[model samples]
Target: MIIGVVLLLVFFLVNISIGSVYIPIPQLIHGLLGADLDKASWETILFLYRIPKAITAVLVGISLSVSGLQMQTFFRNPLAGPYVLGISSGAGLGVAIMIMGGSALGITFSSSSNYMTWGIWGIIISGSLGAILVLLLMSLTAWKIKDSMTLLIIGLMFGSASGAVVSVLSYFGNAEDLKLFTIWSMGSLGGISGTQLEILSIICFIGIIPVIALLKSYNAMLMGERYATSMGVNIKSLRWAMILSTGLLAGSATAFCGPIAFIGIAVPHLARMIFRTGDHRILFPASALIGSCFLLISDAISQIPGSAETLPINVITSLFGAPLVIWLILKRNLSSEF
Candidate 1:
């Protein structure tokens, strides 16, 4: 626990310390401690932009990791992740609808109002609606089907459906809106603001608290459904709670971060490999810490060296995560009896 906490802090510091402009640690700390801000452009950049960006990275990391771990535990599939299942696709679909359609719907904004607030809420509402819709469809087939692989296929189909809609929406959108949408889809941690960050914190903690509170049930769940029932777990109710939690974490992160890829799926594997246990108690928090570290590192790299330009956070994550995922699959296949 101490190691995890320390790593979280280290990564967070790195995230805050490095950006398009360089701000020394001492100066950054002084500013954070309310010192006079009378220095270089880097100081202003650090206090105003990089700090918020880093915080967003931490929150996004926690949300995606927790969501990924829960989905893996719920499905009993090591490969299950928010990105893989298309939950982010739902969130993407939601974001596309809002940024593209908001003008037509007269959801115009004043320069004085918080645009981040509107964007965050729009993503949450749209993403949650899409995620819940998919969940409901999955629930309808839950009792009638017992095949995990088949269920995975259904989830993929739902995700593809959401993606198809997003493509069509893009097709008819004006060039300006399409450019905006494309940039958003590339993703970043810099987009979230202070107020919006608080909202995300509240929603993500509300969802994750229940899953942590039900640790014993999740442990039992890992032992298999029949065994879990033998031990008096309320299988049906538990399923709903897990689904709700996944939606809240996955949807909110997706809404804000613009569909970050791989951390949800990748972090859990890293956690498991480190802890060498299937225990959710240890795995949950471990995943959160590792997930945060992974994203912070990615964000740090996204800030190009000696240049004012930075790559998208999403692009960096995929570059790292995709290879890890491929390696895991190949390792699993090599050991499989089939």
Candidate 2:
């Protein structure tokens, strides 16, 4: 835990420091501490942009990582994640409908009301609804299906269906709207700001709190349902909690930052691998910290430190995460803690 915290702070500072216009670490600290900066623009850039982006990256990491850990435990499948299981895709579809297909539905923002005001909430609400809907569908199948792999495939199918809908919507969408949706789908950490950041932070904590409160129950869950039932754990309520947490965490992040991939699935495994434990008590915090670091690293890389160009945050995550997934597949004895 101590190491994770230290790493998180280090990565966060690094993330903030390594942007398009570089700032020395000492000056960065001085600026943060209310000292005059060498350059006035550096202060503006640090306070207004980089800090918020770093904070957003951290929230995205914690939300997705913690949510990913919950999904892995709930399904008992190594591969289960928000993106792989269709939760993100569902949220993406909802956002797509709101952003791209809104005109078709006769929804329009008046000149007096800019998009940021009403649009942000619309995206969050729609994304939440979509995530909830898919989780409910998965829950129905979860009880009946004993095979983990089969359940994962079902989740993929759900994601595919949602993706198909998004594609159809995209095809008929106005060029400007389609471009907006496309960029959103690619994912972003720098997009969130002021009010949106607050909402995301709140939603993530709401999702995380339940898991923290139920750590013991999650540990029991890993021993098998029959074992958990014998121990008087309420299986029904546990599932619902997981659903609620995952929905809020995954949905809100997707809604605000776009559909980020891999962090959800990859971070939990990284936590397990590094910590060498299956205990939710340890894994939960560990995943959150490692996930934050991973995201900060991704965000820094996306900035293309030496260049003005920045890649979509999603591209970096997938590029790094895909190989980890492939490695996990090849090494069948994953999660030694399990």
Candidate 3:
């Protein structure tokens, strides 16, 4: 835990320091301390932009990673994740409807009074509703399907169906709206402002409460449903909590940052490898810390340090996560560990 915390802080500082304009360590410290900087622009870049972006990266890392852990535990499938289970896609679909459908309906989101406030909340609520809807559908199926692999297949089908809907919406949408949705799908960590950051933080906080409360249930469930049931765990309620927590975390992250891939699927495994334990108590915090560090590093890399150009956040995560998924498949070690 201590090591993870140290790495997280180190990566965070690096993420903030190495953006477009490299701020020297001394200047960065001065800006953080509220001291006058040699250049006013340095302060603006550090406080107004880089700091918030770094914080968003941290929150996203923790949210997706922890949510991934919950999903894997709940379904007992190594490949189960927010993205894999269609939660992220569902959220993306909702955002698409709001952006594309709103235009079709002649509803302008950005021109109205309190547009920023309404716009952010609108996306969040829409994303949450979409995620919850998919989760509920999967929950209902989970009752009849005893096999985890079948449920995994169903989740993938859900993702595909949602993606198809999004494509149809985009095809008939306005050019400007299509462009906006395209850029959003590309994923971004730097787009969030301080206000959006606060809202994201609160939603994540609400989602995490259930995760923390259900740690015991998660540990018991790992032993198998029969054992968990014998121990008096309420299987039904546990599933609901898992779905709710995963939806809030994954939905909020997608709503604000777009459909970020790989982090949700990869981070839990990274945590398991690092801690070499299946205990949720250890894995939970470990995943959060390691996930944050992984994302901070990805954010720094996406900046293409010393260059003006930046790559999409999803691109970097996919490059890192896809190979990990393949390795897990080839090794055939999905349910063996947890």
In order, the Cα lDDT scores of the candidates are 0.76, 0.83, 0.83
- Clash count (model 1, backbone only): 0
Q: Which stretches of candidate 1 lie over 4 Å from their true place?
A: 37-43, 101-153, 324-338
Q: What 10-residue stretch in candidate 1 is worst by lDDT? A: 107-116
Candidate ranking under lDDT, highest first, comes to 3, 2, 1
Regions of candidate 2 where Cα sits further than 4 Å from its true position = 105-126, 132-158, 324-332, 335-338
Candidate 2, residues 1-338, lDDT tens digits: the string is 99889989889899999978998888988988899999999998998889989999999999999988987887787777866567888888887887777867765432225476766567667777777788778878777875556767898899999999999988888776777678877888885678878888998889888999999999998887778879998877787687678878887888778888889888898888778888999999999998899999999999999888999999999997788766865675664545
Pairs with backbone N, CA or C atoms under 3 Å apart (clashes), candidate 2: none
Per-residue CA lDDT of model 3 for 1-338, tens digit only, reads 98778878778888998978998877777767878988888888888889889999999999999999988888777777877677888888888888888877886553545356666667767776777788778788877876656767888899999999999999989887787678778789886777788988998999999999999999998887778989998877887687678878887898788888889878898778767799999999998898788889999999999999999999998996688666865675545555
Off by over 4 Å in 3: 106-125, 132-157, 324-338
Q: What is candidate 1's lDDT per residue for 247-290, written digit by digit as tens?
A: 77877787777788889878888787767777889988998888
